[model samples]
Every structure is written in C-alpha cells, then in structure tokens.
Target: MRTAVVSPKGDSKFLLQMRRGGLVKVYDSCLMAGSLYKSLLVSERTTAEEVVQLVLHCYNSSDRGSKYSLYEVCPIKSYERALHSNELPLRIQQNWPSPEHFCLPPQTESGGHT
Candidate 1:
C-alpha cells in the first residue's frame, strides 16, 4: 500500500488503471465512487490529520486488487510535520473524547442515584 499527500491547495489528482481490460481512468478529487481521491478531498478545508485519517480509511476499505497513483497535492513532509507536531488545534483532538469525560459520576448514598 502507498500513501500520497493531498496538496494544501486541494489540487491533487488520482489515476487508476484496470488490471483486466488495460483501461486507465483519471479522477480529479474524490468525485468517483470507490475512489481513494474521494477520501482525500474532504468537504471544508482539508487538514493534515483528516488527510491521514482518510488515507487510512481508504487503505483499510480497499480490496486486494485496489491500486492507485496519488498526485502530490500537499507535500508529504508537511503531513509528516503535522503528524509529529504536538501543537494540533483543540478541535482536531476533540474527535477522540478524553477518557475522563466518559467516567461515571460519583455514587451517592442511594448506590446509583445522585
């Protein structure tokens, strides 16, 4: 499996070639069904974290014969930096709620009631 970065300008493209009929299909963004490009070209402004998540989603969803060529839209280095950096925005981290937030409330004298 291979990963490609979606350009910051959102100008990346994807090219897929069929194994059986020797047909080549081109895509601009994720407009086609079952296309990885769709995963990358998310609605709203694309973020590095979103890109990574989409790429992983696509990779996991693909069958054995799925293969594609990603046109570099965002540089791979930028994605790497975003991934490694500890300064991600709070909104992005909010996707994974903190474990503390799921903790049960303290038990009252009634055992279950507050």
Candidate 2:
C-alpha cells in the first residue's frame, strides 16, 4: 500500500468531523473535517468556504468532542476541493430535485401510491 511520511510531527491544523446522525467534533491532527463541512455546504444553498469556516469555528469553540482536537484521518484541503468541484455525495443529491421530476405528487395532494 502507498503511504505519506512527514516530519517527526505532521501538520495538526485539521481535525474536526460530523458523523452520520452524530454530533460534530474536532480531532487532534485531522484535516478532512473541512471536506465534510464542504460537503454539507454543497448540500445546502450556501458557499463551500463559508460552511467550512463555520463548522471549523463551531468545533473549536463548542464543547462537543472529548477535547482532543478531533484529528481527521483525511485532509481538509481535499475536502474543500471536492466541495468546490460541486460533486456532492449521492445521499446529498437526493435532497435536491423536485418530487414532480420523479413523478411524485405535490405535498398538498394525497401523494398517490405507485
């Protein structure tokens, strides 16, 4: 397998995350948190960078995690890049698109079964 090796101690400026159905938290030396936040931003109607900063600030100031800095197993820059690309995950994409596009009735209607 391939691997990356840094100095005695690698960069520790990225370590926050929001798990599925779980609260968001920061890590000790993780950077992928930014990516997750970016994904979230894309899902919403907000800018990716704005969302990333909001999440990072929240994790830093909030008492959510165990206080270990919430290091990420991935890099935040990568996450940001992904978000900038406008390539959100399939789950998030589902939230978009009107029901009519899929042949579903409007919410006010009976929502007829297939």
Overall local distance difference test of candidate 2: 0.29
How far is each candidate from the true structure, as Cα RMSD in Å? Answer: 20.3, 17.8
Model 2 Cα lDDT, one tens digit per residue, 1-114 = 234444456564444443333122212123332332222222333333333344446446453222222111223232211333222232333453531122110111132211
**lDDT of each model, Cα atoms only?**
0.29, 0.29
Where does candidate 2 stray beyond 4 Å?
1-43, 61-81, 85-92, 95-114
Lowest summed lDDT window (length 10), candidate 1: 19-28
Q: Give the alpha carbon lDDT tens digit for every residue of 1-114 in model 1.
A: 235544455676765432221111112223234442221223323333433344446547452212222221123233211232222222243343442222111111232311
Question: Candidate 2 versus the native: TM-score?
Answer: 0.23
